[model samples]
Target: MQINGAQMVIEALIAEGVDTVFGYPGGAIMNVYDEIYKQKDFKHILTRHEQAAVHAAEGYAKVSGKVGVAMITSGPGFTNAVTGLADAYMDSIPLVVISGQVPMSLIGTDAFQEIDAVGISRSCTKHNYLVTKAQDLPRVLKEAFHIAATGRPGPVHVDIPKDVTAEIAEFDYSIVLDLETYKPHVKGNPRQIKKVMEAIANAKRPLFYLGGGIINANAAYEVRDLVQKTGIPAVETFMARGVLSCDDQLLIGMLGMHGSYASNMAMSETDLVIGLGVRFDDRVTGKLSEFAKNASVIHVDIDPASISKLVNADYPIVGDVKNVVNEMLELIAGIESQKYKVWRETVQNFAKLHPLTYHEDTERLKPQWVIQRVGELLGDSANISTDVGQHQMWTGQFYPFTRPRQFISSGGLGTMGFGFPAAIGVKAATPEKISINFTGDGSILMNVQELMTAVGNKLPVINIILNNNYLGMVRQWQTLFYDKRHSETDLSVQPDFVKLAEAFGGIGYRVKTKEEFDSALKDAVEKNVVAFIEVIVHRMENVMPMVPAGGSLFNMMLLEKKGEK
Candidate 1:
């Protein structure tokens, strides 16, 4: 079949099973947008900013476990996506970002809407390509999708020149992708699996540290089964919150900078740490020299570069998380479960002693209480997205998500203003399930215009704003480390969030108490409309269980008495 390059791109995407795309239109990309307008097979979300488009695609990918696709124009439009590209790069998300560029002939003449997008995105992407001819369009696109969705998946950039998109080409949608430089390892070595099994069986106090890779690889059940069969306690990273149910007996709480005290203690005392599908970021391994000093680490990751990069492991296996975990489970099929009653009891005692507590007053609303109630109302089936702030910390602490991909947030990048648009994407991808965005007043205001996108698409997403009247996370840092100097952290001029939602043709409610929260949530869920519920909280409230920056995990600041820091 023969078609224009623009039509070929859309057709190829359809064949690739991309049901939804988030994008913005401009001069250089008008041909692609025009092609998209003629098709109703796939959904396109119009975002106010290019960055929102990328983040929304990220949200969709995280929830659907598919390669997220986002399209944009040239120059500033392409540059606007850099932040999101970097975010996905650091988090290892599978994304295909298509950006328009100047025609091939005018490459270096400073043409209108011209920018070196490939060069700009090279460092931030897993791989990138610039299509110089129409004949290469289909192959380049196929390669881009393959690279983006392969092992250790991350963002990939395809810079399509305007001339290339307009050129007529012979499009064969069934061509096999044959890129030699892009092969991904999908299976674990049998010897490596046996080595890990032996280590697990020999260790008395073994712990499994799970991360987002489990969800990405759809191996949550396999991971859970291995832990149960081996009788090893597992702790999840923040992004891997829902890998194991909070009530699972073998599961400990999250581990990292703001993780539970018991989890940190367990990591400290473990004899073997099996890191499954997680990168050992600095936050997870505080003071790297002393992190898991007594443990023999077995690191399993799809990306070869991540192995032995930060924290050296005794054994490293490079393969898909699902395949690797399954192989290990098969190898250790008959291994008897070890009794670690003393070890489990010791951790349980620490958890009870240093339980996560928040002050509850009838006069004022607490963020933790609101998160707990929201989790209770939505149950475990709902998808939740969060912005970076105190609310993010509280949600991680309170929400009990047992299913994978139920919780989405910017963990590694810690990008603010990610919640609302992300919620819209999640709702778009999973229309049958209810999605909510937990945001702070400061973070919501960063991309509040996205409320229009939600209403325009009729995405019934609930937006919960934690109105603390300040930049909560920054203020907490200032209070704790900067000698109580307020600096410019206070956000006194707050927007009327309820009115803002109304302007966008969405429902809005202001909640200040438990009864108000119940009413607002009930109305939001019952009504088929985009809803915003602003929960007003104290300005001085902060997320507790904080380990000071650059400090050891043992030295934690427990916020008990006000003004006692």
Candidate 2:
């Protein structure tokens, strides 16, 4: 059958089992938008901006464990979505972004809304394509989805010219992709798996340092299986927050610069480090020379290049994390679990010494308390999202994630204005569960326009603004290292968030006390509507357990402010 490229795009998406698409319409992509309007097989979320569209796609992918699809127009529209591309690329989120381009005849003419998207996005995207021919659209679109969801997943950009979308072509969704060099290995070598099993058995103090790849590769079940069978203490990186449930006996808290005292201490003293899909990020590895000095690492990751790139692996197994960990489980049935009993007790003592704490005062509302209250109020019923800053760290510290993909945020890029749109997407993907975003006053305003999107779409995502009125993280650094010469971090003069939320046709609240916060939270969750709570917290609160840059994780300040408790 003959069909236009726009119709083929929709048909291919439906064939790929895509149920949702986040996008914005424009002149260059009007043909595709017209087809989207005519189709009823899937849903399209009209986000407020191009950036928010891609972010919503990310949120959808994170929770659904499926490839996210998004669409946008050319020129500035394409440029606007760059942040989301880079964020997904850094974090290995699978995304297929279809961006419209000027007609083929206008190439290199600097035509209206024309730019080299392939050039601009080459570095950030895992792969990209410029589709000028209608006959190739079927294979290119299929390939984009394949590449985006395959090994070391990242965003794949497909630039379709406006003229191509309007042209007629024979449609075929069953066309076999011809690329043979794109295979991704999924199974582990038996010998390497045996070596890892031996290391786990012979070690005295072994720890499992997990990363986002565990979640991306869908290896949570295998990892949890391995951890439970071996009785090894586990510490999750920020992106791998909920691999082990908070109540899991062997689970250590998140380990990084702002990790728990118990986790950092355990990492410093471990003898065998079983690294599962972790890149050993600088945040997790404070000082390279001092990080895990006493340990020999057995690293398992699908990306071969990531192995021994930063930290040399004593036993490197380059295969899918799930497959490798599953193979270990087969061999792990013969091992005993009593070796790390003393090490576990020592780590627990470290936690008892200085737990994740804030000055629990009755007068002022601390950011930690606000985040904790949210966790207490909406356990299991809601998933958490956050924009970057002190609030992001506070949520990471206070909120206990019990399942994978329950906590979504920009881990690598640390992008502000990510949470609100992400929550919108999460809500869109799963309307049965409430979506909550914990954002800072500084971060929320970056994409505040998304409030309209949420309200218009009837996707009720609660926004908890930790209203500190200053860029809290940077201010803490200035106070600690710069002799308190506060620079341009103060954000005291901003619009009333409550009024802003109300202006966007959503519910709003301003809470100054804990009692008020508790009341506001109860009302918001019960109302089940798009709401924003402007929590008037202490203006200068800091994230503790600070491992100063270039310093050892073993040494950290456990205070709200330096030299002051």
Candidate 3:
């Protein structure tokens, strides 16, 4: 059967089981959009911007556990999505971004909207290609999806020249991909697995260090089982928030710079660290020398290079997190859960002594209270996305996340304009559940335009704006370290967020007190429209239990001293 490249592109998407695609059409990619117009098999969402398109795809992927697909034109269209590509790459989110290139004849001739899509995306994308021949679409599309969704999943780019989209070719549906250079090892070695189990069994203060890879591998159940069976006190990184429920007894809490005191202390004093699918990032490790200094590290990851990229592993198991954890479960009978009772008590003591605490006030609305209230109201019934900064930390601390893929944020890239658009994507993927975007005043403005996208598409996502009237996180650093010399972080001259929401054809509410907040939130829930609730919070309040950069995890600024400044 003969078909054009544009038709083949849509066909390939259908064959790959892609149900929804997020994108913005432009001059170079007009043909693909035209083909999209005729397709009924999949739905295409026209986001407000290309960046939103990519971020929405990321949110969709995070929740669906499927490869997210996005399309855009060459040059600025692809460039606009760079941040999202980098974010997806850092978080190991599988995505396929299709870009329309200039005609092959225009290569190196500086044609309109022409740029090196492959070159610019090479550093961020796991793999990329330039397709000039129409007949080559099948193999490239197949390989793109395969590479994007395989081990250590990441974004893949496929740039199809404009001429190729119009070129007629023999379209064969079945083509076996010959990917000799790309193969991911999925099973751990028996010897390494045995050694890891032995270390967990014998260590007096064993700690399970969880990361996002467990969620990526869909191994939350495996990890939870291993933790329960071994009775090891576990601590999660930011991206691993819901792998172990916030209420899980075996879980201490999130461990990192903004981590709970107990979680950080446990990481500091543990005798053994059983890291599953973790990257040992700087935010989590604090000072490398002082981090888990007394502990023997057992790192399990599918990517071999990530094993010792920062902290050297004593026992490195190269395999899928699910596969390795399942192997450990087979040997769980050999380990005794009673041996670590004392260690668990010590961790619990740390939690009691200096927990993730904040000062509560009656006259003013604290950011923590807002988050806690939302968690109490929704629990695991809602999907939450957040932009970077104080609000992101607050969500990590207070949200009662009980399921994998329930919490979405930019962990590695920490992109600011990620939350609202991502919430739109989340709502698109799971229309049955409520999607909420917890964003700060500064962070929300970065992509506030996406409210129009939500409104236009009729996605009743709830955008909870913790409007503190400052770049809250940066202000904290200034208060603590910069001698209160607050440079330009003050966002006092901000737009009326509620009015801004209405301008985008959405409902809005302004809450200055906790009492107002409750009613506003309830109203938003009942309205079930694209809504934004701007809750005015204390401007100077900060994320607590902070371990300053390069400081030991054990040393945290527990509480603000009254009248210290």
Candidate 4:
């Protein structure tokens, strides 16, 4: 039963049911990499960079609904993954990042490749530890996985010194995790659940605001049941997209800054706002004071600290999203049927009047048209990941997601280089799923080297590039508010993206016209290799229904001019 810490690490991963690991090996972590090489249980994906490794793990986690595991060396390797840690932290993704540290004896001797792994990752991780003793490997690794996948899940870091990996220890892969301070509240408080049920029963214009927590808690079915039983309208945030189908009668679409007009308007007019696993972030709330101002908020979250952290909740229920929703549904069963005929009519009118629309051009391909066609062709089955900016918004707005975890993107972090690498992770984890990265020209270049990673690993992912020759999102802001001073935003002298893809050992296509795009996209999808299709879209086509920073969601910039549409 005696094993080295490196073997303990692999054993712990196997015990935790971790089948895949995304990482780049380095000298410090070479022992763990050696141990990884000896095992066929865990599939180790060698990403091009440490950042992409973390992102690939994120993609795997998002799709597989499992705790993502990443391994890297100290110093630059750890630092490279900091962005990914922060991104996962911001979006509450469950991840366990194992970093190799220098020997314990060289702690303060300024050892080579030795930076404070726990110190650097402290802010970004939910919890972190530096393991010096070899015997403590099993316990720490077990706790790390538990913490990463537990309540209000986020990244957890475990720093293993190089010497510890060589030390022998009796490795018992037991599940006796006795961390007294780390218990998550999974059951809803009865009194708070009663209040939510009462509110649901009484309110004529009640609205449910769902967040990433719904998907994180795996409570989509409970949310659907609650919405169906109560007949209440629901709107999802960017992180919680696809909780309900776009065509669901009770659904109003995604809400917040770039939210649908109907969804925002409904939020503005509601009397009761049921916050389900949502943090009520600023981007989603726009002007805080004006956000659901007239509504009595009932916030339900597993993390009690999240309650009233931003917007004060009249009824704060601290429990798991699915558990709380299930309890509420059970409590409200057989209650008198509630109707919001007038409110529904008002919301429908809002939808009809201010529908999500964009200018279509026959001569030039618009971004909206491209996204719509992709949705039409692929349907809602493809695993869609996106880098932040115009393409991110377009995917969220246009894609009709019916299943949970169907659309993945950088939500809280708004990370630019997230899409392609994440698609690689998604494809790696779920090879059967058609994974695609819907990205923009500017965002794609951030970590385009990962194209080689995908091709090398034989992870056939499709990257659809919306080439607009400018930082489209920033240009939109400049055009509307900054008097068209498009300083430093022009990316006209960019590399040929088609050639860039081909250079990375992937199939590349340039499509300017709609017909060409359709043909090229179909061809790319059918190809059993990494493919990139660069679709030339108009630079001036802006993502519409914009809510300027700090502006009330009600007061949106619907169009450039009165008669423009």
Model 3 gets an lDDT of: 0.92
- The per-model lDDT (C-alpha) reads 0.87, 0.90, 0.92, 0.89
lDDT tens per residue, model 3, 39-147: 8999999998999999999999999899999999988998998899989999999999999999999989998998998999999999999998999998899999999
Error of 3 at 21 (Å): 0.5
Q: Each candidate: how many clashes?
A: 0, 0, 0, 0
In model 4, how large is the Cα lDDT of residue 451? 90
Worst window of 10 by summed lDDT in candidate 1: 556-565
Q: In model 3, state the lDDT of residue 74.
A: 88
Q: How accurate is candidate 1 locally (lDDT)?
A: 0.87
> When superposed on Cα atoms, how far off is each prediction in RMSD?
1.5, 1.4, 1.1, 1.2
Task: Compose the digit string of candidate 4's lDDT tens values, residues 417-515.
Answer: 999999999998889878889999999989999998999999988889999899999998899889999988999998987788889899999999988
Q: Which portions of model 1 miss their true places by more than 4 Å?
A: 561-565
Model 1, 262-348: lDDT tens digits are 888888888988999988888887877778889999999888888999889889998999999988878876456755666778778
Q: What are the TM-scores, per candidate, against the unseen true structure?
A: 0.97, 0.98, 0.99, 0.98
Assess candidate 3 and give its TM-score to the true structure. Answer: 0.99
CA deviation > 4 Å runs, candidate 2: 560-565
Candidate 4 lDDT for residue 528: 69
lDDT of 3 at 185: 95
Evaluated at residue 229, the lDDT of candidate 2 is 86
> For this target, which candidate reaches the highest lDDT against the unseen true structure?
3
